[model samples]
Target: MPDLHSIPYLVGAGIVLLHVIGILHVIHAIMTVRTSQGTIAWMVSLIAAPWIAVPIYWVAGRSRFSGYVRARRSDDAELLKLSDDMHRRLREYEIKPDDAFGRAAQFLGGLPFTRGNELTLLIDGEETFESIFKAIHAAEKYLLVNFFIVKNDRIGTRFKDALIARAKAGVQVYFLFDEIGSHRLSRSYLNEMKEAGIHCSHFGANRHWWSRLQINFRNHRKIVVADGKEGFIGGLNVGDEYLGRDQRFGAWRDTHLKLKGPSVQAIQLVFIEDWNWATDEVPDLEWTGQEHTADQVAAIIPTGPADPADSWQLVVAEAANSAQERLWIASPYFVPDGGVLTALQAAAIRGADVRILIPEKADHLLVWLSAFTYYEQTIPFGVKLYRFKKGFLHQKVILVDNKLACVSTANLDNRSFRLNFEISGLTPDPVFVGEVAEMLENDFGNSEPVKVSDFTARAFWFRLACRVARLMAPVQ
Candidate 1:
């Protein structure tokens, strides 16, 4: 009754439809994808294996975040007014003779390097969480909170309780987290926050039906802004694992920063934009920031795929290019793009002390393996490599000579450079740089230098596997 003789015709039609969809996707990749390597890889896969590749491409191939872009543009008028007001308030404490990095940060992050800001480095989970809790408890007016992952564990529960108490006290509290990154966060956990009168939502790439299938882009920022007078940002998310409770990654290593003064206003703006996208309500926040006499000049740089260009990629290369003496970097992942790699090689050849420190124990196997493929090309150019043997190194830090230091949530991988929403605190203060230098010195003391023989002596099959993983770098 089902017309069994038409089976061959149905199969033929399906094949034709697949190719048609594949061809359309190929065109989309060529026109929309920003990276040439990504475009070519997707095109070939879509053409050769449409059945599997088409779905994957539809979900992950798009580079520009249309929803965020549109939301930002829609709020242009209010944001412009806010920017003007902030600049006016920050003008009295403005620092002159700002370096290229500072200037670029002002333009890109829409935040200027205002003086009179106090910055303190919080090392690892114990110190970072302690600082954050104290700051949250001190919140008098409002608090802006965002993270990539917010667990329901011990630390997370403490964090929730603190916020709930503050909300009950009538201090406006806004909490935002990424849906994909916090997929394990129980619904009851979110409901509890809502019941406690905390404004909570998830930032995600799901504004459109097509985007609902796309989970590649993530909000990887971890920020806390309290009363527009203090702020925090860095690599640590809300989880028990970050506190060294997880047996898998024992003694987790990370870094966070605490800022008090005008820079907090900039961090507050980032949360405002993200919250606007989540709730479409741009609530009024304090504009004027407290000033200090400290000589520290800092800027908050926020980058994402919605940007006209790859911002962090350019920043990475610039850090290498502008290094007068030393360029040190530490990241959990070490998959640099071609431009950044070339910049590092050139800097090393030009007599700069270029060092890249990565964790020996990896959470992502492919990224760990792919890093080996790059050693042979970089090490010969005087670029030093070190592997941190003390647990998993998850901090995103960069030190340039004695002038600049950065603590950020952006990794040295394609994902952070292209796909994720990331923020970094850049400072030209000698005090901050000295602290970072000391930290890196201790890190280097604990790490073991990687030699040329280490990579060269790998087994043939292992080398082959690394090479194959390296081929996936564009998408990784």
Candidate 2:
């Protein structure tokens, strides 16, 4: 009954439309894709197969986070003035030499390493939650809380209740969460927070339509800044698994840090910028100059796709490049980009002790499989890999040569390196570095050393699957 003769003409028209869309998308990819490999891959695919590639490009090709960038620039002049003022005030609190990380922070458009800060390493979830709750209860002036994932489970309810209590006590509470990461979060939960007087919003809630569809970019940072005096940042999120309640993960292991001093100011600034982008309203808080005693030196580096370059990625690479005695890293994921892998291999080849610690249990199948591909290439270069047996290892802590240490939410994978927003605290204090060293020592002790034979002895299909997973590394 259909027009059989018109089928050829209809097919020609569809082919023309697909080609037009594909060509336009190729130009867009060339203009927007951050990495050269990504651009070439998209261009070739778009030209080879128009229909399939065009849809895929629309969903995943974009790398820059234009929405947040626009929101950040809305009040550019005012923010610049404020930043200059803060820098002028921080000049007196700057630390002495042996602070290469301070220069790296400057490159990232962040504050320098300041003295007079006290740092406490919270080993796992129980200590982290306890310290955070106690700090929230002590909030008098203002409170800021942000996390990538905020579940409505046991720990999430506790976090919500703490904020509600503070809000009812006349404390100005500002809460931010990632809509994508917390997609399971209920509307009723958000309504309850609004009813309790907490100013809360999703990070990219009001983004442009096109940008909203590009959901790859995420605010993966977890932070809590209270009273402009203390702050917390690290890997643990507000969920029951983080507290080791989920039997699937068995006993969960992670790390967090609590800081009191000028370092808190640097962390608070990171929160303020994210808060401003989300709500487009600035809160009144203290920028008062406090006296310094030069107790400990630390800097906060916040990185995202909005930046001119990959600051957090460069941080990891530079640390690997600069290590002399040893380089130790523990992350839940280990899918490093070319630059980072090269840096680690070079570090090991140059006689530095290079060790990478990953979890025995995997939370993401693609990432877990892809990580094996790297083992074959790196193990021969004096790079040692270990797998934690106690439980999952989700900490993003790094120890560099017993002098520099980092703790943050940034993973070693491409997602944190380029896509997700991250905040890392860099410290050059030996005392703090020593603490990190001891913690990692215990972690490495419990972990089983991986041998090259492990992967070489795998089945044929298993090897093929690992290779296939590795092929998806750039996108994953």
Candidate 3:
């Protein structure tokens, strides 16, 4: 037998230990991974290269966010009571859903479709920020501000100054941001807001030792509420690039929704949960609903990894399945999971006017490449794809038949479906649907139809790269 002190013996023992650990991880992945493709992929990689795959699997493989769930369920009696009170107050304004998609959404989100809401579609950065800053400035009692990214650049400074001004005016301002998304945000930026008496904290997923290696999950919801009466949610973050100031991606196209009425309270509830997760304390804010003159019906759907199932994926699939006339979706990232893809194809096959609008310019190379691989699978079933030519399409808007429209922080990818904490504003009001339809019509007018040959006609290396990128979709 080899000596235990020898380097070669130690090396052999290390290899055995790694393989044993890899097998354990493989077991964990098999028991926990949500998708079959992801399970098979991890099984192969873990067995073949335990040293590399083990570390990666440790970081990105886990599907459940136990820490978040624990935070939500912990002895937080006050938070639970606040949530119960908010829902109790919203019960009077709740509208029972009559359609399949609506029912699915209501069941998945645990929030009812609320009436007496007025929704305004804010297109692009200028309009969104203008409305948000105005709300911040006008906030008299309190403000709830949260975003996935908050930069230290010009727009961010403007946002900071707006909050500071309000805090100085005696408004109780609470700010929350994703640590991963806003890693570049300086401590000085947060200090300034703190000095002005604004409460600030990052959605600290790494606060616990067990969760330190789990960085795949992110809080991607963008929300701002003023006095618990009006609110904003969508894809726009606080950055100059979002305003189309970056030379690399000019004319940044996006969308946000402004809400006035009971639904604003729903948005506020989401913020409360996130804030509670970030800083184990509940803020004092209004839980009552305010009726708007327009009297529109809307629901706020929040989804995340801590959920019982893939909520966003189910919502999108249900939307596709329930659409009878048209289903138009706009997102920068177009990579979809198998279930969602099948739903889209089935929607097309059932004679729905299925159209997917994606950006012509890519901000994420892997996700963009992965999108191409799906054309052959979808185009054959009459699902049409469009590439926005005027600018980069960063909006996450879904229009279902002329009846339902949604502006959400979630994207049409596995990341948004499974990894990120996201919120959506969904409405079935005719006037609001008409507005969304008009907005999408203008967008389609500026887009070019994509042909299946867009992928088939590409070179062998390019096609191979797309397939390789697609294999990484679960974590992307």
Candidate 4:
């Protein structure tokens, strides 16, 4: 018989307990993990080193968000009524689906492609913010502002002042920000907004006690709606760096969209759902929007972990698969999952010109390094990669032939595909598509084509580091 009090016997028993727990977690990962590669990675790590992997997995493993689904489907009669009313009103402007992408996007977003809409492509920060501030100043009823990051810097102060000005004018302003993204924002800033009769809250996965450990998910959407008539969506957060004022990263190149008509209400609907998630109360706002003369066809697609399927990933893969002539994408992060990467390659192989634009500078070291690993896999299959030489390319844009163009907060990475709440505005209107095309053409003119040798010629240690960084892409 073993000595019950002996240290050696106790240590052995503890190790066995950990392994049993690890095995149970492995089963859980197998059942829950979204991708086969992710499942294999978790299974190996859990079995080989449970002591370290278990905690990390507990924090970041699960792809599906808890509590959010319940909150969205809550039996709150008022919320349900508002949703039904919004849908009914939107149906009046809904356009019939003319393509596979349209049908799939509508099914995934639960919103229709609307007519009588106008989309203005706002290039870079100054133009985008100017338009946003102008709309904020002109607000007659209510304003909804949301962003992934809202630094308390120069531009942030301007943004705050704009909201305050509108709020003091008797406009109901509801501001929402991501908790982790705006962690540096002072309490005073929020208090000041509250003092001016504005409703402000931070959104995160930590709303419930059980979800505190699931901090990996983030609300990465950047949105601004004014009086439910005009809206903005894109990559620029409220910060001085986005304005190209940061010396470290000069000339911030990004894209934003100024939307009008029925599409603006669609954007507002997304904001209402997000605000409800944060505050559990929906503010009353205008549900009807005036139709613009442009009459462009557009849709707003919002995707997150609360979704039943990996919505953004499927949307991107569908974009690639549906590309007839050319597929072009520009993003700050390019660490796509296996499915997206395969789709990109398949598009190139099927005689479609596939091109990816990325920034030359390293904003996130791991993400930048991970991108290098994709060169070999992509270039061999005829896909072209370009590095923006003029400035940091932070635009999340996609062009599928001359048919569809999209500006979004979603990136070509696993984080955006699964871990973050993201939104995109897509339009097939030829005029809007032409504007997007001209903008991308100018951006492409400022970029340099990347060759396979760019990665292969790197030093052995650097290449090895890149490969190592690629392993962390799923969580990044």
- Scored by TM-score, the top model is 3
TM-score against truth, every candidate: 0.97, 0.96, 0.98, 0.97
Residue 75 error, candidate 1, Å: 5.0
Clashing pairs in 4: none
Model 1, CA-based lDDT: 0.89
Q: How many clashes in candidate 1?
A: 0
Q: Which residue ranges in model 3 land beyond 4 Å of their true spot?
A: 1-5
Order of models, best TM-score first: 3, 4, 1, 2
The stretch of ten residues in a row with the least summed lDDT in candidate 3 is: 204-213
Alpha-carbon local distance difference test for all models: 0.89, 0.86, 0.93, 0.91
RMSD of each: 1.6, 1.7, 1.6, 1.9
Candidate 3 local lDDT, 191-211, one digit each (tens): 999999999998984368668
Decoy 1 TM-score against native: 0.97
Could you give candidate 1's per-residue lDDT for residues 49-116 as a string of tens digits? 99999988877888878778887877478876776787888888777535775566567666678788
What is candidate 3's TM-score against the reference?
0.98
Which model scores highest in lDDT?
3
lDDT by residue (tens digit), candidate 2, 213-271: 77788899999988988889999999999988888888888999888887787787788
The CA-based lDDT of model 4 is what? 0.91
Please state the error at residue 66 of candidate 3 in Å: 0.8
